[model samples]
Target: MNRQNKISPFLIIVACGLVLLYLHGCTRVRPLPGPAKPPTKAPAKKTEKPRPYKVMGKWYQPLPHARGFKQKGIASWYGKKFHGRKTSNGEIYNMYGVTAAHKTLPLGTYVRVRNLKNNKKIDVRINDRGPFVRGRIIDLSYGAAKKMGIVGAGTAPVEVTALGRPMAGKSAAATVPAYMPVDFYSGNFTIQVGAFSNPDNAEKLKRKLSRIYKNAHVVNDLHEKTAPFKVRVGACSTLDQAAKYETRLIQNGFPDAFIIAE
Candidate 1:
């Protein structure tokens, strides 16, 4: 019995040792992995383009003294091509006259034009719109260019200076009244409204005010750097009407609305 007991204990120990070896073989251990890396990318490049030349957007600021403002550029002339045509201001154009075309200066605005090639200068009134194309600065009437010696040159470099008032010796100064304020009427009473841009906006405002006031209308106000369609609401025939509308406009917005008599 003693011998059997000893053998049994030995066999049991051998079986446990085999079981431990089997467990160690079956439970495999994977090697610890290193951290993964992120992806790399390439950089990109940029390209640029060239711009065109233009002058319409440049000379668009109001001058302190119309006489003080001056500019240099190519000048040309027009004749029978534009004769008898209605100007932007509704005035008839007489190409033989000494009137001049400016990009934006007010109609009736007088400017001193100098032909750089001949050194001859003449004062001309801005009576029409033009030099509508690019590269040219001023467009003079047939007689204006002839007097300034630009007709012979075809196109000449010139300097233009605003005269504030009227041309001293031009026909516009002699025949056409200088600085005549446009008449605005409120019934029998007349008031002048300043210029505005966006004629449709003016028309819209005109209709809105017309519903409330009798003398509402739109007027063309032309000036250098600005051509506006102004909405004149109500022709106040009396100070009372003007005063009443002025108060109403202030209450309805447009706190700056007022009346200027002609």
Candidate 2:
């Protein structure tokens, strides 16, 4: 009987120990509430219409509404110096690509250029602004110039007609404008040595050039209040004379020098 009593006490002690262990295991540590999520940022709104911009003292208004624009005037080509540079439209210029610059056309416009002298046609996308010189209506890329057979002559009389809006993310096709060609005004001949935003810098260049050339001066932009100051030499009587002077300027380290008709 005494042995039975001792075994019962030992069984009771074992049961109590198991119960304590079970209670301890049932108590779980809940992970602290996760950190609050961060707030999301709103997406930026996109601009649909481009704003007017000024360059070299001239304000160029982008024509987003004008379609089927057609004009006839002198067309010039730019190469090497502008290759790989950022165009007015924020695109990297590729001289070999079929692209052109128009002073007032909206960026991403497609146009058809036909060289009247050679009867060659080329379709180019407008991705920049230029031909800032008077009387020039368009500036073609090296590839476009070569395709239209104007590389040899440097400049040619051409008909430029706007095609529809450029095909988004794809190559644009040439389209003929239904409207008649509009004639552009012709300007007098001058040799542009340089264009500067600062009048002081322009004056400095003009003074420096005056030492070599008798007729050197700074011309303020007629349209804009604070536009580019143009340093030009020679109010040459004819385009041929201006061209000869341009050649001389180019030979004398002014590679960007070109004839501008004012």
Candidate 3:
């Protein structure tokens, strides 16, 4: 073997070391990614406020909840004259649907209306606001009225019990009665002694009640030309106190007095 022809081991080892160092300098050693930071939490939504509306010269505030609500009053209905008209809740009036209109209950509320005359009962979803005539509690569709025996008489005494919004069924299926728990949480309660078409009359009643009550105020729409003024008294924090207050009011002189949510 010619010794000059063979490369020296030292040179070969040096060349290999240089090549490894060059490769190391050229190649990037990427670090393993660190644990991902926890995702940021999303902001929560805000609670919405209830909307109040006016009808037939009166301002009506919708109830926040329908728990433990009961009312006794006249119930009437409408048909062909308003068959395709849009209701207060923005639904097209269907006279044949098992729906009703109420002055203050929430638009999506479900109620059990009992005809006091014949004890006939029907469940109706409150999809509109109406029956603004004094002493009337609810206005039913022609179909609902007929089911509860209210169509022939034109009007009937009814005991309306609030059943709240449906829990297991869609509100669109109002024709098929759904029984769900009423979700009425007690809040501020007051006695509505009277509601008058005249502002002066409401003020007079308020003044009279202020003599014997702690808080007697007139809820009015003085800005509106046709809105009726309501005289409410006794700002009780609970429903029981309001019931007692209403009883006292009825006994004192206001026979038409009723309990109302504030």
Candidate 4:
């Protein structure tokens, strides 16, 4: 045994410590920042606004002197499919009868319809609402077109004249009718100079009333339980004008003259 070959226990322990240090250096784990912070809530999205429709054209009524009341467009007739159905006026639709549909005009309105191509004319009651398709002005029932001699062509050039009154069954002899009364909500009012039991009497009074007022019209209240016929004059824009007319009516033999707000 040589003295150089002999090793002390403390020297062996020192060698083991150096080996452990080398292993730790080879397998070192890098220090990482704290776990990633959860993403902060994002701000809420903004809301959107609504859009409006484009109006193609303005609406108007064919005036009394609008002789060229002619509007050229597609004319269509509704038939059996719509028969027996309730019209916009709440009346049962009879396609076999002479009736028509109009937009804007009041339900139960009366209109004089003429087929320009055939020179045929007919009185049609507007019981429903329509001709909703763009460019078309009136929708006539099957019977109405046949009366106007337009069924053969299916569609024809036409002219429409608004009647002086509503379309319900009361005869022209009744009191004045309100075609398009000034809205009562607007505080507009009118007065009747006379009430007639006969249409001829009403017509005579109408002529006289027409001379005094620009908006004079005849109206029939078919829905009324009594006094079905009534004639109304001047849709005064103000209560004072209506009262003035009422005074004139009283002086002219309508002793019971009263104001009618429409």
* Candidate with maximal lDDT: 3
Estimate, for each residue in 1-262, the C-alpha lDDT of model 4 and write its tens digit: 6667779899999999999999999999989889999999999986321111112342222111211122445567888889999987798988898889875454555667877777787777777777767778899999988887777777777887666354356574445543432121234566654455666776776777788667777777555445445677778766557668878877877665566655
Q: Could you tell me the lDDT of residue 216 within candidate 1?
A: 80
Local lDDT at 217 for model 4: 73
lDDT of 1 at 213: 66
Off by over 4 Å in 3: 4-45, 51-59, 117-119, 168-182, 189-235, 239-262
| lDDT of candidate 1 over 1-86, digit per residue (tens) | 45553557889999999999999989979778887766665666542211111245432211112334567999999988779989
Candidates 2 and 3, the one with greater TM-score: 3
Q: How would the candidate models be sorted by lDDT, starting from the highest?
A: 3, 2, 1, 4
User: What's the lDDT for residue 205 in model 3?
Assistant: 84
Candidate 3 differs from the real structure by a C-alpha RMSD in angstroms, to one decimal, of: 6.4
Q: How far is candidate 4 from the true structure (C-alpha RMSD, Å)?
A: 22.2
Off by over 4 Å in 4: 1-74, 166-262
Candidate 1 off by > 4 Å: 1-67, 167-262
lDDT of 2 at 246: 84
Worst lDDT window (10 residues) for model 2?
178-187
lDDT of 3 by residue, 1-262 (tens): 6657888899999999999999998896889999999999888886443545555545455666667889998999999999999998899999999899998788888889999999999888899888888888899999999999878889999999998776664654655655556545467777777878888988998888898998999887455456469889988776668779888988998877777665
**TM-score of every candidate relative to the true structure:** 0.42, 0.48, 0.62, 0.40
lDDT, residue 54, model 2: 61
